[model samples]
Target: MKKLALLLAFPLVCYGLTIDEAVEKAVENNLQIKQQEMEIEKSRYQLEQDKNLFMPEFFMDFSYTTMKDTPYTKLPAGSLPFPLSFKQTNKDFRFFDFGINYYIFTGFARIEKIKISKLDIKANRLMLQEQVNTVSAKTKKAYLDVLMARAVVDVYRKQLEAVQKHLERVKEFYKQGLVARIEILQTKVKLSEIQRNLRKAEGELKIAKAVLQNVMNVNESLEVEPVKISLPDTLNIEELYTRALSNRSVIYSLKERVKQINSLEKIELSQFYPKVAAQLKYFYTDQYPYLDPKENYALVLGLQWKFQGAAPYYGYLKRKTENSKLRLRLQEIKNDIKLEVKAAYERFLTAKANLNVAESSLAEAEEYYRMVVEQFKNQLASTTDVLDAESMLTSARKGREISYYQLLKAYVDLEKAVGGSLKDEK
Candidate 1:
């Protein structure tokens, strides 16, 4: 229980990073990840707004009109006199109206729109998850790159030391009149080459650290130490493909899109039915010597129907057409996802094979270099033989590092293809 407590508090501890810590930092500080989080929040608020569609809306309005002269209404007198007259309007007047409008029926359009808004929220969340996964994968790749570059530097450093020693021994032989001057010149050339390679390796290591620092959203230089890459004895492609279909964010987002489209189809179906709304209003008007002055209120029911336009039908038909297209697009995406997973898996297997070969070659080269060194100490092997063996051994060591890094990179790609974390298996 104590250990678990420490584990739960691990994020509070600051020190050198592991892969998981690097990923956590990236998710917390990366701009793209934060942007997606904001997008999810925006969608959540929009969903809340959509839910308010069923509630009444309040409005207040005012109007004023001006005329050149006072007006009067003239009514025809049937038998008593020539005409009847009454004051009807003021030259200038103003009125105020306040009301609450509520919908009674919308042919289920409001409900369907709300459902679609909910799906949009889900889609935004899935997009955020997708961004998280992308950042995680890229962080791991950068971490591995730092390690690989550092290893290359180490390899070149060791080779430079070995060649420097050989150059000194060659000069000593020339002084003793045992080797020719040309041999010394050759050893100097080899030493210069190793020095150049070491410098280039150092430069590469710095660049790799910069890339890693950028990915982590930090400004400090890094001396990164990461977990060793491991591969399983066997993998089942079918199992991985199945998990990807269920777990991938793109697929799930698309599924939500299909739901939204279906909801829109239902919304368009409402075009055939009348839209009904209820309203309550209160009004106040003051016009001197033109009409009676009193407070007025009313409750009204209204019905609206459209029968002439083809717009709603066209909208519904468009969604229906896209429905078939969406399904087809989803199937295409699945096939593409399967192909990506399979290709990455194949590369992983190839990298593993290459690593095996490189390891075996390193072992053989080490033994050969040792034998050659012994022979040179006994004056039985020529300087050329020793130089060749050392070069071959360094080459093999560099090759092994390259192969190891490639294998790790390939594993990362495979995990990304599946849109999940595969390091747990290791």
Candidate 2:
């Protein structure tokens, strides 16, 4: 009969959502996921631009110059035995040049550049994966929180109804002169207290719902029934530690950063070597209308070896140092995750034990309440004793829900520590 009453008390909410469905919706609509995807495309475009460095590049040039005065190379008055005549030209000059250069070598710098861009794309992909896991974990927790709050409301309402029935019994006893009038007054006070508590629980339920909706990025208020997610059947902390070390996306992305550093170091080393290039050029010049030169073209070979200050060498060494630090940091992350798995496993076990105790205590409290009520009806027990029994029962039930919800949250944390979704947890 209690079960039927609990069922009838539940509001028939229209929407029902599983945790997995919520995770899917969060990932699909999440802005960070879109940004990471765009970064991948940006890397690809950068790769194309780097490759274009080796392709033929064309350019054109035009220039005009004017001096205020005509100038001539004048001989000293008696510097040479032969007679000299001074010549002056107009102070205007114009020219045009066109060329194409094909850069063929950069001490393998081009090859390393391509590799770095590719690694960037891979890193961005890992970033997307990490975002998905993070969002999914949050969604799972929030979704379960709504359910936990709902359960608390339900528990409070049921207990409130039971206390109301007790209040009526006490009133009847007072009318029969079997109980003092103070007993009826005490019962009414308890009823009012439970009603206030029930209101708080209902308000909490609404807040939990709002929190879940906010996570899902929905504007409309939803009436969702969260499907219960069961705890894992078995937990192996050591196994989870090993899996997290191997499968965590954060570690993978850091490893990719290490790869990028290595590629950069190689490219920096390539800068010290000589580079060869081939070029083709054409030009035309006209000092005056009657002195136009023919269209001229040339094929040229080029070699370059430039010296850099000590800063570049220092940068190369810095790259090496950065890679070393990242490797150590990755190892540190693994240690941290191992510690998390251990701690979460312990909390889960504790919550599980507490839940068991709460369930047993609830049964005892209910039996005691029944016996106390019967004694009160028979004029053998005081009304205060019956009220105390009912209070104990309510406390036991409330404790049970608290423990159960704590276990739920701990289980979610455990899954996160293992670096995966609850459904696929090992």
Candidate 3:
């Protein structure tokens, strides 16, 4: 009865952290997210490169040359003595050429390329979103782990206190000749055992904190304290699963890939058509047995046509059109995600059931401990019986604590599988 009163009087301390703060810290610190951000920047640059493809290209060339020996060379009619209009000549010459070229048309291929690049950029953005989902899940799981570890340590501490107090009472009773010395020694041993268990739990708590720190991008050696486990009463697995499928980053990325492939297919199809381009050239030459340099500056226009029979163009079109394979793969991924969501949801339900059982067992164990302690004080129960009750009560408390944490973790996994953060859902 006295032991029960003491146990009831033990206060539960709530310590350290909020869920939102933990998530914010993780987002700021996670290395993987930073890498994804870089990829987004890269994609932006690629989009810019695609835009530049439409602009004109400017080029210039200069040459200075000397021919050491004279030889016959080609010349215009009546310009040379030989009947054949040819010469091997030695000469010194300087020349420069400058030109600008722009594609006036590419059968709409340039337009398609721009579209493809835009799609790629969109895909990269979706990739970042996927990374966000993954990181958020990992961070929340790690945070819950720390909370569970802390809860376990607290439970152990409570057991240790109970056992230590029992040992003190046994010692006092022994000194008063009310109990055997063996009883006092046995209680002392039990107290020491509980202390050892407490220390082990504390060690695990430290390891859990380290894992949380890693997820949050904190220095590995830095300490972190997470929120107390105040299990939410109004849990909804169905709603969470729905949110996950809709908000998951991986799904969004896959959708982007599909769009990108669609654009690629369109660009490939454009290869079968003719292209048109505009050209202009400027040139100067000296000492050439040829037309005047001013004559080389004439404007030019060009056209390029791909024969329908061209192997490479058809090959590209064939390849891109076959991307239904990728679409089917995406569909398969969606099915797999559905199964994963189902499994996680089931796990959460099972854990919740088990927790309820554990809670009931804890209540029974506490009552049993209270009754046995009273009987022992009245000299109606043996020391072994009292010890057994203490053991039962401690075991029940520990089991309940473990089950609560496990249930909490199962909930966390379900959230991850669904791809939505619980906080965000709320």
Candidate 4:
């Protein structure tokens, strides 16, 4: 009984998840990231297959045959005695062959194909990185939302408590005939409003937690640690644009696409040239026909060229046009990135200023509320005045909470626009 009582007396502890930890969990578990990784693996395998085009291919063949009649040469009726005939081949025979085939030249088509495959692999990897960055930014924003909701709930709870305490004071004053009956009624009304708002805030907090859990792809409930509002001390717009251009995976992926297009163009150009191949073979047969060797080895070289109604030239032209389009697209992406960085930077600055204003307003509201409460106790202020002061204070607290989190979110957006963490910047 004593052990049971001691166990019941202890409080359950839950560790809080940090923003970085949440982002890591989200990235590690996201289905899109997993799919992108698979795509990269597939491209790597394709690269291996392309490289194998340069290596020799080994082959073997076997056959057994039964003829309906023996293969023979018959003498002409007037030239032969007694219509004689000579057997040329056995009725039943077996044959076997072994060979190696190699491409001596394919106008460098194989080399270009290999280069395109390698570029594909690099492009897929960059896409994966881009996906990771997107997920990380989303997770951070979700985490901040949870923190903001929790803060709002706390503010509402405190407001509820204050209103309840004031109601009791108002009731006491009414009993002593120091205040009017309407004072108690007004106080009751304020207390009820706070209770309703508190409930709403609580519900919002639950939703925020659920959203965070869903983003992290976790089954268990999450408790996130409160984060301090810390803005970067300096931000250079030009430097940020430079970092975004250099570090963004999308840009790099596009560049890889350009390289792949170049390789493809080369491959298409090679199609106009002839292909040369060599084959070496060893053969054996159970029966030999006239002038046929029972077993032998041979080396052969072959060349092939086809004219396909100007198709090769047209294909080369197509690839060249596509290459030009890709380069233009790359330039367009760079321009968009610069614009994104600029917008995010401006938002961060706005949020920062809003936070500063909210901080000052909150302090002033707190002081004003305290003074109004004191005045009410001395009968110098009415219940309406007290309620008004409390309302202003509640709004101020809520504003401060919202502003702080918005600033954090804005900073996260800026980091996302920069394509990496700003803290890593020198």
Cand. 3 Cα-lDDT: 0.75
What are the candidates' C-alpha RMSDs?
Answer: 5.4, 5.5, 7.4, 2.8
lDDT of 1 by residue, 1-426 (tens): 999999999967656678788889888989998888888888888889988999999999999988898888788988657888877866788889999999999999999988988899898889888888888889998998888888988998898888788788878877888778987788788888888998999999898879888988988655666586566777788988987887789888888989999999988878888999999999877655645655689999999987568888898999999987998998998999999999999999999999999999999999999999888767788878988999999999999999999898898888888998665542
CA lDDT, every model vs. true structure: 0.86, 0.81, 0.75, 0.91
Kindly list the per-residue Cα lDDT of model 3 for residues 1-426, writing each as its tens digit: 999987877754444566667778888888988988888888888889889889998888998888875456455657556556454432776778889888887767677777777777777777777777677767777777777777778887887777777777777777888888888778777778888888998899898878888888786344346544444455565676667668766777777677777666667767777788777878877746554443377577888886656664666667576567777877787777778888887887888999899999999999999998888777777678888898888788878877887887777777668775465444
Question: Model 2's lDDT to the true fold?
Answer: 0.81
Stretches of candidate 4 above 4 Å error?
Answer: 1-12, 65-75, 78-93, 285-292, 424-426
lDDT winner: 4
Q: What 10-residue stretch in candidate 1 is worst by lDDT? A: 286-295
The better-scoring model by lDDT among 2 and 3 is 2
lDDT of 2 by residue, 1-426 (tens): 999987887755456676777788878877778788899999999999988877888989988878887666576657787656554544787678888988788888888888888888888888788788777778877887787788888878887888788778878877888888998888888888888988999999898888888778776666556466667777777778788787778888888889989988887788788888887888776544445354678899999988587665787898999999999998898788789889988998898989999999989998999899898878889878987888898888888887888888888777777777556654
Question: What C-alpha root-mean-square deviation, in Å, does candidate 4 show against the real structure?
Answer: 2.8
Scored by Cα lDDT, where does model 4 land? Answer: 0.91
Ranking by lDDT: 4, 1, 2, 3
Error of 3 at 115 (Å): 1.4
